[model samples]
Target: MSSPQSPQSPQPSQQPKQGIACLGVLGVVALVVILLVVINRGGGGSSDDADASPSPYVPSSAPYTPPGDPYTPTTDPYASGDPYSSPSPEPSPYTSGTCLNGTLPDSTTAQSVSGVEEVSCSASDAHYKVIETVPLSTDLSRCNGNPRTQYAFSYRYTLNGATINSYVYCLVGLGSYAR
Candidate 1:
């Protein structure tokens, strides 16, 4: 029998396949470059160009407060008055005369005192001293409209010597005064 003819060697031509593959890759690369250029061009416009003609902003006139009369003076809500000019009423002298076992005098009175030179306290002795006597009015009418005046006398102390401080308070108002 004649030997079967060897199958034709597979053609070794790779150039056409390589060329087609290269063309496909080049096509994809070109598409990407074109897309990038379009995207960059689109992103270049700015809001500044749109606002090039800035209109002058004019504020509307506020409700006019017809120039000052006593009833319409500009009063500052947070303004404070001189403490000395309008002194608060003094609190009553502390009737208890001694600090209670676990209590101290209220600090408001201490602050209101006209002549408190210095205050000192010792933890061991549980004592306090105010170098100078502070004068305060205990009458409520004097400090009316002020809540701080009400409890002003509830706490206060004067250091006596080294081991004792006297606690004191004043009666604010008599019921008769309310009438």
Candidate 2:
């Protein structure tokens, strides 16, 4: 019969290989632990780090100013000292007794005219005198066919569907002029 086989021992080279593989695993775990410690050390907002410098990300207390002139509100025309102030009535430049110079375009018949200049009644060049001033209306009956009424003129300015200014002049011939 063959001699009884002795218990086999692991090869020396295989033993060293197992040892190196275990050392590589340990090295990886140690490297991970060191990285975690480094990250936590620099992290912000820990109360325990009382003397730590302020973070660069914090905003300053001063207000940020723009490059150009600062914003300013425009003047309000409606505003007065009184909070309940109402709009004052506009005074009409052509009143009932005002005289005007410059010849009429249609001197023979009563008609609407323009380019008339205001003058004193005593002025030598005065050609027409305003007998009555009134608000303009669609009907001409107010200034039409009257014996003394020589001409009628309406002036007005409108902006954005609203009348900004308006006037109607009912005039009579002055001097030797006839209607």
Candidate 3:
């Protein structure tokens, strides 16, 4: 009888295993190439065909106006026929008058009082003759440290031989302060 073969010897079946692995690798590569070709083919569109199509119709009623074009001078309907006509001058400031016995001439005019030593005036308040007229001095320190640009008339009268000082607290923007 022949001697028993050794178990560590090389086997012939390993050659077929290597061939199977190579075939699998080649198949994957071919599939990837086919996918790439299909994708690239769909993206290629003819530019000539796009230009041959009919363009969209636009109405001629609205002509294209370039911004660089010179602007035409417009005639104002309220303007006088004369181009050189001067604008009307503004009305003069408040008119000064004398007060009789602490009584004011018209309730609309401002007047000074000696009792409280305070100046007060209002259209709704009783008309009183103004003793003296003085411009209001505004303080902007309370306006968030910002300068006060505008002010409305608060008091029409001032103390006799005494000066009155006015102050503005809050500012008005967008109906109130920005913050």
Candidate 4:
């Protein structure tokens, strides 16, 4: 406990080991910082494999058609008729007494109803057929002052299994309303 040759603390010759260990830790930290700097410098930031570049700003153009312009009508322009003339009668494709799956004759088809015995909803077999079509009179007197005279055509559809009387009424080309 009282030996003068040996000191209470560690000897001076062993101090270099402490310094070496501290310096080694600092050297490893410096190497890690240098490696991070070199790796970041090599990268372009914009991922080339993932395609992170901003898309180009492109203004869209109108769609093109070959034969018919969508803005123009297909009807004959030189036909002798008034531009504001009244719409033709029975303009609707369907009327009352049409089933859900039933295919009724259109205005053009019904116009020549005298020729068509019945219209077939089926392409091969008889699925639904228009049995009878009678043109009712367009009289507003039946409906007091109401323009419901569009109920002019009476269509009847029949399916072999008990008749599903799904009556659907539709009329086109009523004159412009008093709006």
Candidates 1 and 4, the one with greater TM-score: 4
* lDDT (tens digit, per residue) of candidate 4 on 87-122: 553334343333223233433222312322223333
Error of 2 at 178 (Å): 3.7
- Cα RMSD for predicted model 3: 18.4
Candidate order by TM-score, decreasing, is 2, 4, 3, 1
Sort the predicted structures by lDDT, highest score first.
2, 4, 1, 3
Candidate 3's displacement at residue 124, Å, is: 99
Over 4 Å off in model 1, which ranges?
A: 1-13, 43-179
Relative to the true structure, how large is the alpha-carbon lDDT of every model? Answer: 0.43, 0.72, 0.41, 0.43
Give the per-residue lDDT digits (tens) of candidate 2, residues 7-72: 998778988899999999999999999888886887543686777777677666877997766565
Q: Which scores higher on lDDT, 1 or 3?
A: 1
Q: Name the runs in model 4 displaced over 4 angstroms.
A: 1-9, 43-50, 55-179
Using Cα atoms with residue i matched to residue i, what is each candidate's TM-score against the true structure? 0.19, 0.42, 0.21, 0.23
Judged by lDDT against the true structure, how good is candidate 1?
0.43
Choose the strongest candidate by lDDT: 2
Question: Clash totals for all models, in order?
Answer: 17, 0, 5, 0
RMSD of each: 18.6, 18.1, 18.4, 19.6
lDDT of 4: 0.43
